[model samples]
Structures are given as structure tokens and as C-alpha cells.
Target: MNLETIQANARSSLGDALKSISVQGVAEHSGKAYGIVALMYHRLALCEMLADVRVDRFQVLLCKSALVRIHLMRLAASGKAAHPLTTCASQNFSFVDAITAGQLDLAVELARLTSDRHEPRSEYEDDFLLHRFMQKRLLHLHAGEDHDFQSLMDRWERIVEGEHAPYFDVCRALLQRDGEGFHDALLAVIEERGRLFRQKDVYPEDARRTDGALFMNGLALLRLAELNGMPTQREYPNIPHFARLPVSKLPLPLDSWMRPEEGLPV
Candidate 1:
């Protein structure tokens, strides 16, 4: 579906979910009632944020993290058992959107898979793979920037040494591949890292910084790719439209009106 359709669907679904949970008498103690409602409200806010197609990957990661927390809160309200509200909220999430736009489903699934079980091995593996992907994308996008290149690679190596080896291996494979367009390669990496963030709450701040760095670096790569005769997707041409000009431009500096200090020649 197009962005508009997706956003509208998300909005309607979120509104309905909020209304359903607004049942009266659900709140007994005044303080507990406020707390429960506040939690639900927080979930609704996350849903709204997720619905906005313009949200960047970093924002999506944050929203999904909040959603997971909200799910846990719902579980608590249900006496530590899975509740229908939780299921409904989860169902509202569009996995396709998560995959294509956010890559958050991976993190969400990982969190769920490990919640009650000991899956440290699998978790570490996923973390390594994510770190590698981020590194590859950074390198490709910032091919000649030695400092950025080394920094990204260093981070990946550290993650590999840490608890995310499998993730590192996966990233290594992708990076080793050739012939992918810079944009395509970068987007793929973004999708994967998005998934990682969704699964593990690994370095929210660092992930955000990395994402921003990649975007700025990608813009530079796109320009360089064009300069190197690489084909790029055609963007719509800007069309000029009639509009009133500003009443006037800002006044030029008074220094321009003043004559220069007396010189030897006129």
C-alpha cells in the first residue's frame, strides 16, 4: 500500500484500540487507575508515531521500544499473563511496514523469543550480524572517508567480540558482495539494523547517531555515484508555481552605502 493508505489505516486502528480500552469501572483505586490509563495512553502515542510514514528509522526504533514496554505493562495488568489487549495491539502492527520502513519487527520478535527463555546465543548472533551490516553500509556510503570508515569498522569488530557474533558473520557476507548500487546496499543495511534495534535495545543513542551519520554519508555517496557515471533513479522534476514575492528583501548592510575610508586615490 502507498504511504497515505498505510498512515490512514494505522490511525483508524489506533483510535479504535484506544476507545476499546477506555471502559469504565476498569479503574478501582484512583492512583492505580491513573497509572493504568497513562500506560495505555503511552501505547497510543507510540502507535501514532509508528503510523506516521515520515518518521525516520531512529524514531521508529524508539517507538517500537516503547511499544514493547507497553506490552509488558499490559501483561502486568493482566496479572502477568498474556492479555487480549496485548494481542490486539500486537496484531495492529503491520509487519510488512515494519520490514520495509522500520525493520523493528526483528527486534520485537527477538525480545519476545527471549523473554521467557535463555537465548543468549541467538541474541548475540543477531547482534553481530546487525553490527556488520551497519559497518558495511557505512563503508560503502563513505568509501573515501578513512576516519568514518575506521570508526564504523571498529564498532563492528567490537560487537563481534562482544555478544553478537552471528550478526557479525551475516554482515560480513553482505559487505563482501559486489555490484550492488550504493543506495540499494545502504537501504538493505538500514533495514537489517532496524530489525536489530527492534530485537535488542542495543545502544539506542549510538544507533540513532549511526543512522544519522549514514544518511548524511549517503547523500554524499549519491552525489559521488552520479559523478562516477552510476545510474540513479529519476526523481520528479520540480515545477515552478506562481506566488507573490516577499514584500521586500532584507535591507543591505549600511556598510555598503558608506564609502570606503579615504585612500590615496579617489
Candidate 2:
């Protein structure tokens, strides 16, 4: 089939996956449930990378993701679900994405999670620094906390992860309030990701390996720059103007059946 048909089919599969999960059943606290919910949001967010950015749909999806993550977090806190299978991308679940999508309440709720609620800490230095960077971004955006990120930046500077280092430098410049550094490093990061997308055969097969090649994390960092009162570049390579549209803090109205409190909507 055509690309559109493929995308629609993929989305439909996600819907079917959701249908398989029940809200008030044994699946409510299941790793499967959490993964599905997270994947739903993740896909929607990546879809923003498309040339036709759907700001309205983005709000709805972000709302849905935030609510489900909150529900899952509450369950985890109450010993119902054991933290709901977080990956490096979902360490804090929906907070950074909520910020990128401009969901204030969701960002607040995500911040309240046991200091980001990221489980199974990484032994590698890069992961540790990234986690710290995410925390710094969250705090900087939400509470306007001018945290001292010099230490983290220095540590990231010392690491040698090629192509990914520019991203770290972008974060460093952001936390350090270096607009020129932010601009320069951000361009490198964006182009590097663009290069990888052009040569994705060597890359992992997941969300980043999609059609639009939209850099959601890079977008998030741009949003952080805006939030920090820094002048941001109007555009970047491999990043879309559509994905940069300002989204609403309020998510669209979810169907009653989609409510997490009632369980998986299945």
C-alpha cells in the first residue's frame, strides 16, 4: 500500500492494541498496558515531525498520554503497577513531551513524580548525564530554576559519543544560557540527526526511524530555549516548522471510554 495507508494501518494497530487492554482488569497494571499507552503518545509525538503538523491532534494525544501516565504513576505509587516500564525516552514518561506540547498541568504532575520517576538507573556516564540534563530542563521550564548545570555539561563534554555530543552541547549551552553556543550546537545536532536519517540502515529500528524524520527531542530543547527567555532560531535543519507550532496547554477532550481512572478503555 501507499505511505498514507501504511501510516493509517499502523495507527489502527495501535487502536487495536488499546482495545486489548482493559481498565479495571488484570491488565490495568500490566506492563503491556503501560507500553501501549506510552507507544500511543510516542507515535503521536513523532507524527508531529511530519510536514503537516497537526497541532489540534497533538493536544488531544498529549492530553491522553499525560492522563494515562499520571494514572499509571498513581498506581505505581500505590503499589498497583511497578512503575510501568520506562525506557530512556520515557524516564519521566510525559513531562518533557508535555512541555514540548505545552501541557502545563501535565508537566506539573510529571514533575511531582519521584524526581522524574525514572527507574533502573544507567551505569554508563552518558545516560546519567542525560537524565540529569532532562531534570535540569524540566526544572528550568516549569519552575524557572536556574540550576547550576556546569558540572553536568562538563561531564557531557568529557564523554565521546560522536554525533550525539552536539546534542549534549546544545543542552549545555541551553543550561548555561549561551545563545550563540545554543544556536551553533543545535545546528550540529539537527544536521547530525538529519544525516543519520539519511543513512538509517545503521540505526536502531524504532520511533526515530520514521518517515518525517522530525527530531522531537530537538524540538523539546527549542521549546526549553523559548521558555528560558532565550532568543531561539526561527528554524533548524531536519526540524519542521509545522512541528514548531505553539500547542495548547489544555489537551483536547478525550472520549469517556478513554478515561484512565476507569481502566484501559477496552
Best by lDDT: 2
Q: Compared with the true structure, what per-residue lDDT tens digits does model 2 show for residues 117-139? A: 23455235565566557656667
Q: Ten consecutive residues with minimal summed lDDT in candidate 1?
A: 236-245
Model 2 ranges off by over 4 Å: 1-3, 23-28, 48-51, 81-84, 87-93, 114-125, 145-148, 154-164, 202-212, 251-266
* TM-score of every model versus the real structure: 0.27, 0.75
For candidate 2, what is the lDDT? 0.61
Q: Write the per-residue lDDT of candidate 1 for residues 84-189, one digit (tens) a residue.
A: 3332222222221222222333323322322222134334433333423342343344343232334545666775566534333433433444224344555554
lDDT (0 to 1) per candidate = 0.34, 0.61
- Candidate 1 lDDT at 12 equals 55
